[model samples]
Target: MARFEEIGTATIPGDGTRLRLLQRNDEFSIKVAGTTGELMNSRLHGSEDALATLACDRIASQPEARVLIGGLGMGFTLAAALSALPQDARVTVAELVPEVEAWNRGPLGSAAGYPLHDARASVHIGDVAELLREGKGSWDAILLDVDNGPEGMTRKENNWLYSPAGISAAQRSLSSDGVLAYWSAGPEHAFTERLRRAGLSVEPVTVRALRPGKGARHVIWLAW
Candidate 1:
């Protein structure tokens, strides 16, 4: 077995929390400084890919579709979205952590094929919520893979994105027929209901962390 090697560290903006990056052969993992498990792993990104494809597929044929992606972890979702959209489509990704974006542009990019360099992709170095609040009807699809979903997440601030107001903000950020997708480590019934209460239809999808039939299940909520 290959041992993990510490490669780098980054500090989260708001509360100054730290994230550590480790490499084990070709695999990379990002973990909160004092946490037990990884926040992201390059090899286990099935759900992350699904978070983009499922939403992007819905708007692939829309002429010049606009997409907003939150949390650029390893660029898996961004890469997946770019692959599913039309050539003229525009995709904007917002990543709260500056270092996270830097990591994506560095050697860490190989895991997800460096989607940032794609012609249709744009990067935002601020919170996704800011875009949701400011960019009304700006996207044909919005995909969020921030923090750890809606429950017991490490970042308390991310909770707003799952709140009733947050749900409303997300809805307003999208075009009338647009779709919004959220990625989580597991399913959160309350969050699903909140989406329902917001009057947007929601579908909870279970996806594997690794390849099909090989890893733990993660949840993706698609609402429109």
Candidate 2:
């Protein structure tokens, strides 16, 4: 049996909480310090990949599409988004933790095919909300995989990103016909309705951790 070895650590800005990067042989995982469950893993990124693909699919026709990803995670979502979009599409990923970005540029890079290496992909080492607030009608699509979805686990500050004002900001940050997508650890009916109350159309899609039907079920809300 291979034991997971801690390779690196990073502190969440607002909460001062730590996120640890672990590796067991060829596989990698990220977990909150002192947590048992993996926040993200190299092997179980199916839903993560789907989050970007689903959102990118909606805007595939735009040759120079501008996509903003809320979390870097393992770079799976960014890579998937890059793969689904046209060559000219621009993708920017906002990762709150600087160490996470470094991991993606280091040993953790290979797990998601070193997405940061892509020329069209860039990174913002700050809160994704900052960009949303300033980027009115700037992005064609916004995919948020931040903090375990609407019902955040790691950081309480992340709650605002799912709040009414946050949803409105995301709505306003989009170009006409822009789509917003979210990835959750589980179903969140309340969040879905919250989007509707904010005057946006929402579509909730269910996907698996490993594939279309091979692992635990997860929810992805695609709203516009």
Candidate 3:
């Protein structure tokens, strides 16, 4: 078996502990406590690209739009979102952990070529949920790729982002025609219902990005 190498470490804000970032060949993994999880599976690819593409595709009609992306995981989504939008678009990225933000700004940036350097990118080092509560009708699109999904999660507080109240807050934050998109590891019918129950037009789209040639399945839920 290939040995996993220690890439670096970062502490989760307010959690008062540290998490380990690891690498096994091309795969990037994170471990909270003793359990290991892949932050970006080189074999499966990261799901961030799917969420970004879905949201950008929905907001392409707007000439100068504002986009809010939750989570700055390896910057795959940020890179994808930047590529999908017009130069006039502005993107505000909210990340919960300050250390995670630092990682992206430093070493990880080198790995990904620092996509946040784009003129349109702004990084907010705080909880995305609090950012969502600032006001109503603020963003043209909100793409959430913070966790695994509504059903399977890495953190407890993240569950609020997918709950009935969280969906309602998201609806309020969206412009009249704004789109809210989420990337899940797999299909989540209950979450789709919650979006509809929140009075947004919901659609499910699956994407893939696996092997160099083959593709991986990515499930996206979009709400307006």
The TM-scores of all predictions, comma-separated, are: 0.97, 0.98, 0.89
Report each candidate's C-alpha RMSD, comma-separated, in the order given. Answer: 1.1, 0.8, 2.4
Clashing pairs in 2: none
| Angstrom error at residue 138, model 3 | 1.3
Per-residue alpha-carbon lDDT of candidate 1 for residues 77-129, written as tens digits (9 for 90 to 100): 99999999889999999998898889999978999998998989989999999
lDDT winner, 1 or 2: 2
lDDT of 2 at 118: 95
| Deviation (Å) of 145 in candidate 1 | 0.5
Q: For candidate 1, give the lDDT of residue 67.
A: 95
User: Candidate 2: what lDDT?
Assistant: 0.93
Worst 10 residues of 1 by lDDT: 146-155
Deviating ranges (above 4 Å) for candidate 2: none
Residue-level lDDT for 167 in candidate 1? 87
Span of ten consecutive residues with least summed lDDT in model 3: 37-46
Question: Who wins the TM-score comparison?
Answer: 2
Position 176, candidate 1: lDDT: 83
